[model samples]
Structures are given as structure tokens and as C-alpha cells.
Target: MRNTISLRIADFLKSYPPFHLLEQEELKSIAEEITVQYNYKGEHLFKQEDPCKPYFYLIQQGAVEIYQNENGKEITLDQCDEGDLFGLRPLFAGKHYSISAKTLEESIFYLIPIQAFKPITVNNPKVSEYLLSSLASNTHTPYYTESPSRGNLDLTSDIHELQTVHYNKKLISCSKDTTIKDLAGLMNLHSVGSVVILEDGKPTGIVTDKDIRVKVASGNWDIQMPVKEIMNSPVICYPASLTASQAHLAMMKHRISHICITEDGTPNSNALGIVAEHDLIVSQGNNPYFLMKALLRAKKTKDLKKIRRNITALLEQYIKSNIPMTHISRVMFELNDATIKKCIALSIKKMNTPPPCKFAWMSLGSQGRKEQLLLTDQDNAIVFEDQDEASYPDIHTYFMELAKNVNKRLLKIGFDYCPADMMAGNPKWCLSLSQWKEQFSDWVKSPIDDHILLCQVFFDYDISYGELNLVNALADHIFKVTSDLPIFKANLARSALLNPSPMGFFRQFLLETNGEYKDFFDLKKRALIPITDAARVLILEHQVKNINNTFERYEKLAELEPQNRELYLSASYATKVLLKFRTRQGLMHGDSGRFIDLKSLSKEEKVKLKRCFNTIGDLQDLIKLRYKLVNLI
Candidate 1:
């Protein structure tokens, strides 16, 4: 007979994962064994290295925090709320706890015993898998924290590489004798990209949309010809047990978009299904392929705006899944790049004439660094090749009109206008190659506060569209001018120290005292800028050009300065943590995520954020001493 408390617990358990996978009888049986416990805010459920309690916890009422002690300081790992599970690590490892769990608010918990749950995990694969996913999600940090090659951030260890891909079981096929026109009809009717050519149940060859478009639509071949005329013979085939990585490799090797799956892993065997590049992308869950395709097909600014929103959605998903920031940033960067390119393409069509001369569209600031994960203000410039002075006016006027159209369209596409008039449409930013080189040289020679700030923004520029040589020329000019100037480097490093420490005298976050964000921590100014500024100065000192991403800069700095590798690597990890934190905050509140409210954060969250500050403080000290900024400033 079930007691009222046990019944109520079972009802609650049914609503969440792993528990929902169990039968009603099984859920009740497990709930019968759960021991109810209560704790006040700040009470430890279990401490680091504590013996494994017989029961792990399920939060029933309030919040809990999982944290670990590193070098005598507590670093929060994750926070849990109602319906979340904690204390499961030791149950799997059969060792003392690696971290501590504590209540963040006065809370009630259903402490599910290990014995009651262990059998369920063994009997139910779905339950075990769900629990393991939960464990994997919460246990690991976003970027690797303790690997020796930590600077490199190995992205090759993708889980999708090992996971089996599900292919299209409904194979669309045509006989070798079928007319190309009928084959096209078959593919159009089925809404499939490729059609397998089969004879006697065995695979023969394949015809794809590309084949039809290139061969028939291009007027190179008649549609009345048999498919055998255009079919890619000896179809590249894989076994039904093909993984996404394997499929991707095969696609790349053969330079084909589709692969035939067969009963055996060869073309000689009976065909089973088809795996296209599209299938592999869809299987990955967050589809960059679809987004890129949408960008290419986008005809108007509104279409591009909708696609940019999708990119944000993808970013939010990536953050929630704990995808490595290195991977997430690269994906977002590419998508962002594609959107900018598409915008330029659409804008050029609006013009009555083509570009007067070859020009490079430079995306500056966070967009330039490829660190932008959310919609932000436009920061862009234009660098066209130098032309004869007599023709320069016409060229400049033409490009200015082009820049205005692009900026206005970008504004329409959700990238807000630059508040400081820093975009390409501004007459000051749109310039010839020689003019940009002169401008950069002047900034480096001057090195005042404002000039240094402009240098910081412009130096991270990457070519979004146009001639690469012009952008490369500007970069070469920057490195050449700043190469012999020690004082310029010193001033640049001094600028890194301009922001006060993220932590105040009491070691609390230095919150903004007066502004729209009063009492909110200035995350960008206090933390991100310091690290970015330091990286730029250090990388420039090394004369390493083109590597603009902040974390990548730190990684490069680590490699270049072996003596300071650990510190540089720590700075890289801290950049990831801060960016991830900011991205989360932005997604949660639908804002820029620059100003974080102290009151809204859990104690554990505050601790996690504080961990990054140590790295920033150490980095600034290094800059101050190395650059002799102490004496100069």
C-alpha cells in the first residue's frame, strides 16, 4: 500500500526525465524508497571528497549549487533548480564526491537511494542514457580545463564523428534506361535531390540535382537522353552502418553530395538507402548547412533578418548543449560572414552600376573578431584600391552610394546602425587603400586614448567581401608602422589597464554606480575588454597578423611565450567562460549582456564569474610590468 507522500512524490517524478521513462508501478516503487530531506539556504548537501551517500538528491522545492574547491578557492560548476538532479557522480564512479552540492535557497529534496536507482539504470537503457546525458552535460566545463595541449582546444573529438547516421530509407531510384526528363519528374515528384540507378536489385549509379542542372538545364545535353548518359557510374557506396564522419569524408573524397548505402559496404551489393550532405547536417541537430543555404537564397533584407534570428536560436541551442565555445564561435562566425556577404550581394544589385574598383568590405569590432554571437550594432569600413586622382572622385562617390545601400539594408536586417557613426556608410571610414594605411599610421604614431580605442576596433578587421590583397596590404602597413615603436606598444598595453579590476577592494564585482545600469556589473568594460586589449597588444608585439579571435590570440600567445604558457592558456579558458556567461545572460534577458544584475545571480554563479577575474587581474599585472606602463602612466 502506497502512502500519500509516496504517491505525491511519484506524481512529481512522472513529469521529469528518466522518471518519465519508467512505468507507473516502477515509479511508485522508486518513490516509496525516496527519503525526504530539508535544508536551509547555504547548507551543504554534500561536500567535496565526502563519502558517497546511499541516496543522491532530486530537488523538489528550490535551488542547489554544485561547486569544487580549486587552490583554496571555491569555483562553482553548475546550478540546479526544481526537478533537477544532483549527487549522481559518485553513484557512477563509486568514489568520494569530486564536488560539493549545497542549497542556494531553503529547499526540499527527494533523496533517491542508489540501490533503488542502480537497478533501473541497468534494466532501462533509455533511463541510463538520459541520466548519462545529464551527467555529461553538467560535469564538464565548456572548454577543456586541464589538458596539457589545452591551448590548441582539440575540436576533432566530435561525438557526431562516432555516432551512426540515419539515412533516407525511402530510396528514390531510376533504371539506366529511363529518360532524363522522366528521371527529373521522378525526383521532383518525390522531392528528393538524388535518384539511385539500379539494375537487378544491385546499385549501378546515381543522378543528382546538380547533374540535371549542369547537364540538362545548361543546354549541354538533351533531357530526352537516357539517365545512363549523365549518371555518375559506379556509385560511391557505404555500409548501412556508416557514421556521419565517414559519410562526410566519402563525400569530400568523391566530390559528390550523395552516397549510396547498401546491404554490404560496396557498390556491388544491393542498395539500401541514401545519405546526402543534407542528411548529415540535419542529423547534427543544429543545421548550419540550412542557414547557409537560406543565406544564399535570401532575396531581400527581411529574408536575411529572419535568417539572422535563426542564427541566434542556433547560438542559444549551442550554449545550452555546452558545445565548446571554440566550436560555437567558429560556427556563428561563418554564418555571420555569410549573412554579411549576402547583404553585400543584395545591396550591389540595388546599384545601377557595378563597383568602380575592387574594394574590400571590412567588418570591425566584435564582428571583426568573430566573437559576436548576438545581434549588435554595425561596425564596418570599406577599403577600395587606390586609383588615379582624376578618377578617384567618381570611384569614391560610387562606392559611397554602395556603402550607404549596404548599411541601410543591414539596418533593415536587424544589425542596428552604429551609434558612433563607425560604419562604412560614414565618409570617414569609407576610404581608398592609401588613405586607410595613412589613417592607421597616424593612429599608431599618435597613440592617444581615442586613437588607441580606434586602433583596437579597426585592427581586428577581416575582409567580409572583395579583394583580399587590399586588406592584407592594410595589415602589413599596421605591423610595419607599430614594429619599431616601443612607446606605441607601451601605450597600447597601458590601454589594456584602463579598466579597473573586475573585482573591487572587497573582492566583489565592481558594479556600475551611476547610469542606466546602476548596480549592474559592466561585464564587457571590466572583463572582456581587458583580456581583448591585452591579447591585441601581446599578439601585435609578436607581430602575428590576421589572427583576430581573442581566445585564439591567447592560444597563439601561449605557443609564442612558453614561459607564460599556463597564464596565457588560463586567459584563453577565462575568455571562453566569460563569453559563455555573457551569451547566456544575453539570451536569458534578450539584451546585449554587457551589464549583469548582481541580485539576479546565484551565489554559485557569482563564484563562477569571480574565477575568471583572477586571470584578468594576473594578465593586467603582466601587461603593466612588461610594458613599463607603471612608470609611463
Candidate 2:
């Protein structure tokens, strides 16, 4: 007969794997021998090389992170949540534990004794095979696959951006004729922050808690007024079938907190439910929303710097959870953009007077392309409105002071100064619109090998602040000059192919011959830069502007050239793989992930990294042939 505790344990065990394959009586019998334990957050369950415990663990609640110490740094191998089984590999192998497991939160675990579980595995071939396969693959469960060499687990697919979002089916709504007081009451009754305004069974407008607080309470308006007066009309609506990424984009693009879900995703259709930014934040467990809020509220540069640490932590969590790189890149880019905007805002306050004229702050290189993830050197420039020679000196002087203050804030916030002095604070980079145009025209019309490097850096500019028209005009000037110039494109292609192939004759990584990083594989120079350079030249030739990201450029290229769609798509995938690889290496080593130590890589990892080299070689060949750079090289 089963006791209450054993019955409770069996009930929970029946839902997870292995035990899910067992007969009820057998599972209950095994559960009777189970011992339950409790742990607090940050507590360690086991350490690397410790003798294997007599049992394996199943998380009943909370989370555990499995990690290993490498060069005195803890590298996270896997994270286990409720209903996940761990510590089974050591038990099966009869060897010491190779990694340490610790609680990420206060946790409750059910320890299944090996003595009791061994007999069941022998009788159930399915259970034994599952365990053996999971152990051999270095995976904690069948749901995730782990790489034996890097210990990184693949938990998500690349197309997670297309996953349908979960919206609130229990939508709180009111009639447009309802008074503000009643609408507030309706929202309070349902414990919701928003109420959709419906007219004739369709959403006509939406009123949120902010509307009430900002208009009625702050403006001291009559509470008896109809909601139509304060409610925002033509409510943003999307189909109930909207994906998570789509929902996020809609909310961001509209600058709204809530989105109305309708039958047809248009305001004309009947409302099905509502999706809140908060709901998506909770669903995805990525907290860019809160981080943005903190950034907006921050008063000092130190506060912004502190928030950047949280951003890094959030980025690490996203990578570990296997969030889609596209979504990750977008979130990080927005946060970085916001940080810079806030810095400029604070810097303006330090000035005795406002700007002399319209200007635009430009972020260059990787940041301009929206592909930056790690805290790297800052690359920025300034472009103000074109001015006559009379007032040009004064306008330039005022903006220069402002740019210097902004640059100092960024450095304090952890972005290192560019070793080559490529920041806006430099007089050479901070220029009037005409000077920038002439500078670009000079580089494009006269394409020197050395000048191509500067062109590459300046071409991918994104406006961080000030006037957009200024930057747009600059972009227009670039296309105008480069559209008819094939020589420049050829030189750019030659630059892309300057680095030797990433792989040597014997399938070894091409190591740097000499430098501070001697014998280390330059992932950036050999792999990333080639792909980026090719993308830039190809996009320029096609007259495609605003698509600066290398992978995105390849994806766009795939659409434009149907005959070579396969090659372009392969380049896109390879770009993402290499970016993620570099990010992981940076996070582990606490430095730029450009230089890779070949000795540290597992054979499996080496093989995976090498797989990307084939696409690189093919891309270089295509660039050489398409640009007629064979003779030039």
C-alpha cells in the first residue's frame, strides 16, 4: 500500500519522461524509495569531479544551472527547470561528475535512488535506450540536444520568431458611450490595466490606465465624460494569429502598450482578445521592456552604466535560452539606441544653450548595422546641416562640445574609445553635411585600397539622434556616387577577399601569423569581415539602402537573385552561426570573441565551426567572379 508522500511523489513523476514510460505500480514502488531535498538560490547541489551521488535528481520546482569551471571561469552548460531530470549521466557512467549543478532559485528536488531505478531500466528497454542516448549526447533530456565539445544546448529552432503568441482571452472591454469612471471601474473589477472600447461588436478605440492617469487625474478632467473623449481611437489591431515577434514589432512601431487582437487582424473585424507588452515580456521572459523603462528613468551616467550590466546579463540569458538571434539582435539594438539617446539628452542639459542648428548623431560600423552584441569600441560620427562658411565655424564648435560630452558619457558607460579615433568628438568625423558628402564622394570616385577601409566604416551609418533628414540626404549622396561606379565595387570586393581562406589545406583554422593574438584564429578578420564586406558591395550594387546587417543583406540578396538563392541563403545562415559562436566565446572569456584558442575547442566544436568555412570560400569566389576582381587580384 502506498503512503500519502509516496503517492504524491509518484503523481509528479508520472508526468515527466522515463517515469512516464513506467507502469503505475512500478513508478509508485520506485517513488517510495525516493528522498526529497530542498535548496536555496545560489546553492550548489554538486561540484565538478565530486564523487557521483547514489541517485539522480528531478526538479520538482524552481531551476538548476549546470556549469563547469574553465580557467577559473564558470561556463554554463545547461539550465534545468521544473519536471527536468539531471545528474543521471554520472550515475550511468559510474564516473565522477564532470560539471557542477547549482540552484538558480530556491528549489525542491526529488532524488531517485539508482538502486531502485536500475532494475526498472533493465526491464524497460525504452527507458534504458532513452537514458543511454541522452547520456551519450550529453543532454539533460530528450527535448534539448547538447554539443559534446562546447557543452552548449540547442533548445529552440531558428524560426522561433514565427511562434504564435499567447494573448489574453479574457479581454475586459466597454462601450464607447461608457463614462470614464465606469471604464475605470470595469478595469479594476477585472484586475486589468486596459479596456477595449467596443461599438456594435467591434473595437473602435482603446483606453489604458495611462489615459486615465494622464488625462483625467493629471488634467483634472470630469470623471463623468464619455471614454471616447480620452480613449485613443482607431486602436492598433492585429489578427489573433500574430506571432510573438510580430506582436513585439507592432507594439514598438506604434509606441503602444496594448494591441487589440481581432478576427481578421484589422480594426474592422470583431475583437478576439488583447495582447499587452507586459504579457509578451512575461511569456518570453526577456526583460527589455523593464530595462528600457529603467533607462528612461535614469538621471546619471552611472545609473545608465549599471543598467548596461543588466543588459549584458539579459543578453547572456537570451543566448543560453537559445532565443532566436534576430529577436536578440533587435532587442539589444533598441536598448543600445535608447542608451545613446539618453546620453545625448543628458549632455544637452550641460550646455548653456541649445544647438545652433539641426544636426544628426550617426553610429557607424557594427552598431550602425545593428549587429553589435558585446561591449566593443565606440564608432560614431556627427553630421549637421550644411552652413555657409561665415557661421559654419561657430556651429561646428557648439556641436563639437556637445559630441565630446556625449562621448565621455559613453566611455563611462563601458563602451571603450576607438583606438583609431573614429568617434564624433574628433573634428575630422564631426562635419557639416556638404563636407561629409564631399568626403564620401572623394572616397567613392577615387577608390584606393586604403580608402576602401574608411568607405566601409562610413557607409553603414545609422542615426542615433537629431535630424533624420540630414542622415537620409547623406545616404542619398552615397547611392548617387556608387550607383554608376563599378571600379569602387571591384576594389571593395578585392578587400573582402584579402584574407586567406579560413580553413587551411588540412582542415585546420587559419591562425594569425603574428600580433598580440599570434596563433589564434581571427574569427572577425577571416570570417565576419569578408561576409560583411561582400554584403555591403552587393547591396550597394543593387542600390539597396537601409539593409545594413550582413545576414539581412544576404537574405535580401537571396530575394533579388533567384538563380543564386541557395548560396545567398547559406551565407545568411553561416553569418548567424558565426555571430552566435563569437558571442558565446566572448561571454565565456570576458573579451571580444574574435580570437579563438584552437586548443580549447572540442573536436565536435571544431567540426561545427569548420562547416561555416565552406560558405565563406564560396561567397569569396562569387564576389571575385561577379565583380570581375580575378584580374584585379
Number of clashing pairs per prediction, in order: 0, 2
- Summarize candidate 2's per-residue lDDT along 1-633 as a digit string, tens digits: 539999999988887677889999998899899999999988999898898889889988766777788888565555566677778865585678877889876899999888889989989977876676456434465423333142322223122344578989898988888999999999888989899998876999999999899999986778999999898989999887798778878888999999999999888989999998887866754357667878899999999999999889878876765444555676788889899999999999889999989999999999999888999999999999989889988899999999999999999999999999999999999999999999999998889976899999998889999999999899899999988888888888888788757888887788989989999999998889888887888788888877788887887887689788657866776787788789989998999899999898865457556757877888888887897766644
lDDT per residue for candidate 1 within 1-633, as digits (tens), equals 649999999999986666888999999999999999999988998898888888778888766767678888555555566666777765576568878888766899998988888999999976775566555544323222232232543333344455578988899997999999999999999999999999987889899999999999999999899999999989999898787778888888989999989998888888889998977876664456667778889998998888887778878877875666777787788888898998899889888988878999999999899898888899999999999989999999988888998899888878899999999999999999999989999999999999988998998988999999999999899989999999889888888888857887889788889978898898999999998998898899888878999998988887789899667867887798789899999999999898998899876467667767888988988888898766643
TM-score of 1: 0.66
lDDT of 2 at 618: 85
RMSD of each: 9.3, 16.7
Name the weakest run of 10 consecutive residues (lDDT summed) in model 1. Answer: 140-149
Ten-residue region with minimum lDDT total, candidate 2: 150-159
Clash count in backbone of candidate 2: 2
Q: List the residue pairs that clash in candidate 2.
A: 238-265, 239-265
lDDT of each: 0.83, 0.82
Q: What is the lDDT of candidate 1?
A: 0.83
- Reference-based lDDT, residue 110, model 2: 95
